[model samples]
Target: MNQFVRIQYVFIVALFAVVVAVSGCRSSTKTYSPEDVVHYDESYDASDKKKIVRDLVDPLVQDTFPLARQTEKPILVVYGISNRTSEHISTDGITDDIRMELLKSGKYSFVNETQRANIEKELNYQYSGNVDPSTRLQKAKQLGAEYMLTGTLRSIEKKQPRQVRLQKKTLKYYSLNIELTNIETSLIEWADKVEIVRESSKPFIGW
Candidate 1:
């Protein structure tokens, strides 16, 4: 009888422990869904800018360069792209996208800023030593680039309130200008401008 009672007690304890362990292991995971509404008044989509630069600006510049008889493997000099806007925009990203496309087209070569700086430093160091003066000038001429490319980005914003509701609309207009200048002749061989606009609507959600 005592043996049977002991077995029953052990079984009951084991069953209780199992129940506690199973309940302790219970857990749930949740995933959040993005809001269906859009917010913010001013935002520039970087991806869109990259796509536009590659698709529109690169071909135009390539065509212009070929027309100018600058068929040689011209080394690219990135002059400047001024951002005349209120927002902090990375004009370099856009220029880089265009540069990559230009490189893939195999029509030109680029002198990156770092490479140019290193070349200049080495040239200076060589000239400072016992190297002949004529040899320095010859090397400089050999590495001299044929042309420079430059551009600017400008933005114009206009905001208007809707007539029927408490909502406002913002229009952002961006103008991109590019120019190719001949380094030997100091002449602008080609120039072009492209403009794009994006609009966003803001609703008065009580936040």
Candidate 2:
């Protein structure tokens, strides 16, 4: 009887522990907004950078076609932006932000460069023996981009030696340059740049 009672007690304790653990885990889980700024630092932040780039590119593209040509949105493909900065910055993220902004502005249509392989595979499958010929899409009917959008992100860092001991300062200048070029004419239609500067200083004092 004692052994059976001990087993029942152990089972009850384990069930209670599991319930408490689950409740604790559920309470610890959190959801954060993309626009939320938790903390600021000297280094570049992804969310902050996205916002800045979006603001910089929105107006430039909004007026690209003018008021009359707004209806005739041009097709654009993101050729890609190179990250020439010292740190590991997400050029893809910046490109995505710019694309989203342009999309929201309804100024241009975008081609998915990252999904080219998948798109081709799907097209191939549709052309295979499985899919119905009547429903299959025509070959070479895909819309080609009229313009290519590309850019580069570069940073210049400067460090100054202090005249006195235990004093130093560093300045980082970040620049994002974006250009849109006509594929057929080989002419740049639009070009713009955005800059951000961050400065860090250390004093001869304790924190």
| lDDT (CA) per prediction | 0.72, 0.79
Residue 205 lDDT (model 1): 59
List candidate 1 stretches off by more than 4 Å. Answer: 1-42, 58-71, 120-142, 161-164
Which candidate has the top score in TM-score? 2
Sliding window of 10 residues with minimal summed lDDT for model 2: 60-69
Q: Which one is best on lDDT?
A: 2
Off by over 4 Å in 2: 1-33, 36-39, 61-68, 162-167, 202-207
How high is the lDDT of residue 177 in model 1? 81
Per-residue lDDT for 41-154 in model 2, tens only? 456687657666776676656555452166778888998899999999888888887788878777678889889999999999998889999999888988889889899989
Query: Measured by C-alpha RMSD in angstroms, how accurate is candidate 2?
Result: 12.5
Q: For candidate 1, write residues 96-174 as lDDT tens digits.
A: 8777777777777877764677878788877797777767654646455677888888889998845777777889887
lDDT of 2: 0.79
TM-score of 2: 0.74
Clash totals, every prediction: 0, 0
Q: Give model 2's clash tally.
A: 0
- Candidate 1 worst ten-residue window by lDDT: 32-41
